[model samples]
Target: MVVREDSVETKHEAIELVLARLLRLGSLVAAALLAVGLTAMVVGLTGIAPRLITAGLLVLLGTPVLRVAAAALIFVRERDWYFAFFCAVVLAALATGILLGRAGG
Candidate 1:
């Protein structure tokens, strides 16, 4: 019974390790997409290149955001309210920056 309940600190660490592994895999896939996109662009495949590039960029950009989110969830589950609050703030800031940058560009 007692053994069935996992502690928060250890859970946080385990989640982080999994996220790290996922991030690496995501990076590899993103790179492949980028390469294919660029190759298609060079070969004048009009419809596919930009889409592939966009997909790659989305994956790259989203990975960190996902990391923050996962951390936030873990923090919440652990009842680490302060860290969870800060994570929310960081996410808001990041979203605002992305929105502003897109609008400005």
Candidate 2:
């Protein structure tokens, strides 16, 4: 079986497009949640506003991590060891930072 260069490039482009869309969707959702939360707060619905804001912030923070995980999965599926390894390292670092931040706090 032979894989052509153009096909590989196409696959790469498709993967990038998927990732880009994921990021854009995440950002939009987070922004919407934040906006609603703030509006709720201004309208005096304080009880649920904070929770909504926190959720939005969490989603914003997790977006990049999710993107990395998705990329890692895609790379692993495509048998791209180098990119997969780098993604793993980045994930580890992100995890470590979160852990350290929590511990310090």
Candidate 3:
């Protein structure tokens, strides 16, 4: 099975495009949520404002994790074991940190 150089480049480019779009959409949604939350707070809709702000912050924080997961999936699909393994390791570390933080907190 001959994997052409151009095909490899195309795959990488596609991965990058997908990742970029993911990040952009995540950021836009988080920003919109945050803005709306702030506006609601200013308008005295205190009941839901904090929840909205928290949701926005959680989305912002989760974006990078999602990016890593996406990259891992892409690499796995491409049969790029090295990068897929690296992504898995990073995800494991992130999960460990989160668990430890929660336990300590």
Model 1: weakest 10-residue lDDT segment is 1-10
Off-target runs (Cα >4 Å) in candidate 3 are: 1-3, 11-13
What is the C-alpha local distance difference test score of each model? 0.87, 0.91, 0.93
State, as a TM-score between 0 and 1, how close model 2 is to the true structure. 0.86
User: Where is model 2 more than 4 Å wrong at Cα?
Assistant: 1-3, 11-13
Angstrom error at residue 29, model 1: 2.5
Q: What is the TM-score of each candidate against the true structure?
A: 0.71, 0.86, 0.90
- Per-residue lDDT, model 2, residue 84, is 98
Residues 2-79, candidate 2: write the lDDT tens digits.
566467666666678879998999999999999999999999999999999999999998999999999999888777
TM-score of decoy 1: 0.71
Model 2 Cα shift for residue 7 (angstroms) = 2.5
Instruction: Give residue 65's error in model 3 in angstroms.
Output: 0.4
Candidate 2: 10-residue stretch with minimal lDDT: 1-10
What tens-digit string does per-residue lDDT give for candidate 1 at 19-81? 788799889989999999999999999899999999999999888898899889877876779
